[model samples]
Target chain A: MRHARIIFDGRELDIDIDANDRITTSEGEVLDVALDSDQITWLPPVKEPGTIFALGINYADHATELAFEPPKEPLIFIKHANTLTGHKQVSYRPDGIEYQHYECELVAVIGKSGKNIKREDALDYVAGYTVCNDFAIRDYLENYYRPNLRVKSRDSLLPMGPWIVDTADIPNANALKLTTTVNGKLTQDGSTKDMIFDVPFVIEYLSKVMTLNPGDMICTGTPHGIVDCQPGDTIVCTIEDICSLETRMVSEQEYYGDKY
Target chain B: MTANTLVNSKLVCVALNDKAQLAALDATFNEAPYKKPPTQPVLYYKPRNTWSVDGAEVEWAKDFDGNDVAEMVVGASLGVVIGKETCRVSAEDALNYVAGYTIVGDFSLPEASYYRPDIKGKCLDTSAPVGPEIVAADKIANPDALTVTISVNGELKSTFELGNMERSVAELISIISRIMTLQAGEIIAVGFAGDRVAVAKGDKVEASIEGVGTLTNTLGGA
Candidate 1:
């Protein structure tokens, strides 16, 4: 089943999507109101996620493209809750940044809480999966903490989800195809099969270190072929069987202030 | 409210940048992750759920090492509690944003590498024991000139001075504020700067700061 968190009729509602991709109120019996995509505003599927853990070099192709060896262990980093923005929202490009790129990734949403979860029991802890455009500002990138917080965790930088597809529906997560487009042109393409660390191992490895809470999310890393995006560019990122996320880039001056 | 509930505040752990501590860890590992200490403050979040106060008994997670009981490395560090919403504040003006200070007992299952920040190793529930009481920030005549000591069962294990920290409290706030807004009531744990000692079941671990009160907790199986 596909679920969406959206603003409908002046209220934030969790709506269900039918087979036809139509939004229906998640109440008993079908509602008379069927909202179109343009009529409502999208919010990230999870509200106030406890922790946002992201993988650094989970794809061999992405790792090779960046000229780094495949790590012996999962390279990970934390993105604060403040960075989350919803689908069809504006991601700000801070002033005086030369290189800003958009990373298309598949996000795992943890449902059941567990610690030291075994690989065999890993999938059982996953609630569902979604899409995330893990946007980064490369100008602030310092090798000190490569992909440092200033580079990855900027406000409104992470655009995630139009819907979350339940795990029961996506039986073969590793087989899904992921693609990203800039404006109207396809820029990058890959598959979950390219993941150096698959979903179950990622969960098991992380669970051994900390408790995976219900709302916490793990963003499986992006693939190769990432390219720079600028203000006024609409970037659409999609993962097969999950959801599509659309984000437009705007100069910080256009949204907040030039000094931000 | 019970005195036991005082530890519900947000906890942030700063990692690395202690010259002696890094030297110790670097020597123990076969290959050093960093030739020089990290230039930036590598920070991690300890959610409110991990908070535990004095006299509160903490359970070793059932899944930990598949044993009913487990051992942990007890790390003690100073914590700075934000008094106001601070953003893009300079180091010169950062102290004005601090409300008070406290000691935090940051316990973790032993692990190597600060590069990835293993969540399972650091964020276990009841793993972070904080507070005896908050010492008003102003009362700390020189926050940088203080000593921290850790003891297991009353036996002194390690002693380190805050003056050895690579970054001062004001610099940490200044650097962090430039990245994300530091809200009121949240804490920034000035990372530990000395050797850590192991504590297991029935061992009472105590971490004390010169000015701030000591935070003590006894480790035992559930």
Candidate 2:
């Protein structure tokens, strides 16, 4: 079963998507509207997301590509809730900035609250999986909190959802293929199997220091093949059996107009 | 305790906002990794799991020997609470978006380097204790002129002036809002100085800002 939150006809709804891609209410009343219709606006699958944890270099190949060694422990960072936008949202590409890249990642949404969770029991805490495009502007990167919020947590930078696929459906979340495309051309291709710290280890590691609450999302880091994005580019990040999250990059001027 | 309900969103904190902290690391600014001093506000987030109310008992982190880490740094700071959705406002108008002020105790295990985000040392559960009560923004004449003091078991450990910050409360809001929108009920902790005090397990820690309430918490054995 896949679940989603959306705004249809100016009404926010908690919907479920059937295997045939039909939208239905929680009570199973099928809606006549299609997801791509103008009347519907997709929101992040999680209605009210809790803490958003992101891995910086979870993939060994990605670490090597960036000229860094694999970390001994998970290198995690937090993103504010305001950074999130839904599928088909527009993320701003700052004017005259160089090297703004998209990171396609698989996100694990926590369903249960627990501390000191063991690796073997971590899966029980996950509600489902989704996809996110963790876009970063490398030009703003600084060593003081490398990958600072300015570079990563800008508004609408993280485009997530479409919907969340249940944990039971994935069977092996670590073996899935993750891909990213720019204007319908494949730009990144990788597998979750390359993650130095898998989902269970990440969950266990984080829960050791703090409680993992429901709606807390862990964006498992992206793979290597990153290409700088442009104003008119549409980037789609997809995870097998989960979601294909789409985002359109627009100029800072276009996004804010004369407001800024 | 009721003040915790006011903070339903993220706690964004600025690093090295203190002139003293920046001065202490002035020589290293030209070094590798950081070729220049921060040109922009260095920001990080304290996740919801780290949020605890005033007077709460926070567990101390344990060492490899299963014993408690000797001490943790006390980051006494003034928290600016936002009243509305604020974005790209000027410093002159930033105060209008502020709702109130509170005391925040950003406790963390002491670390030597500031090159990376100290997730393990700073983001432990109950590491950030906010509030006794919020003092309405209008009630405080000058937040930057306030003095912040830290006490351990009723003993004065450290005292610093908020005026030492490189960025004022309004400027931080103005600058940060240029990149991200600060939602209502969220907090932005105006940074603490390098002269941080340390407290050990079983010690009662209190951080108070002039014109704002005091936030008290005790470090408990893990």
lDDT tens digits, residues A74-164, model 2? 8888887788999998999988788999999999999989987889999999999999989989998888888788888888898899899
Runs in model 2 deviating more than 4 A are: A35-38, B1-3, B63-67
Which tens-of-lDDT digit does each residue in A15-84 have in candidate 1? 7887777667666435345444476889988865767888987899999998889988787777766688
Alpha-carbon lDDT, every model: 0.79, 0.87
> How big is the positional error of residue A131 in model 1, measured in Å on the Cα after superposition?
0.8
What is the per-residue lDDT of model 1 for residues B9-36, given as tens digits with 9 covering 90 to 100? 3466777747677667654433444445
Error of 1 at A143 (Å): 5.7
**How close is each model in CA RMSD to the real structure?**
3.8, 1.8
Query: Per-residue error at A134 for model 2, in Å?
Result: 0.2
Per-candidate clash tally: 5, 0
Question: Please, what are the lDDT tens digits per residue for candidate 2 over residues B1-222?
Answer: 123544768788888888987987888887877888998888888788778888898778764344677778888889999999998899999999999999878888886767777787877888888898889999998888998888999999988787888999989999889888888889999888777787777899999886787899998883
For candidate 2, the per-residue lDDT at B156 reads 92
**lDDT against true structure, model 2:** 0.87
**Native-to-model Cα distance after best TM-score fit, residue B60 in candidate 2, in Å:** 1.7
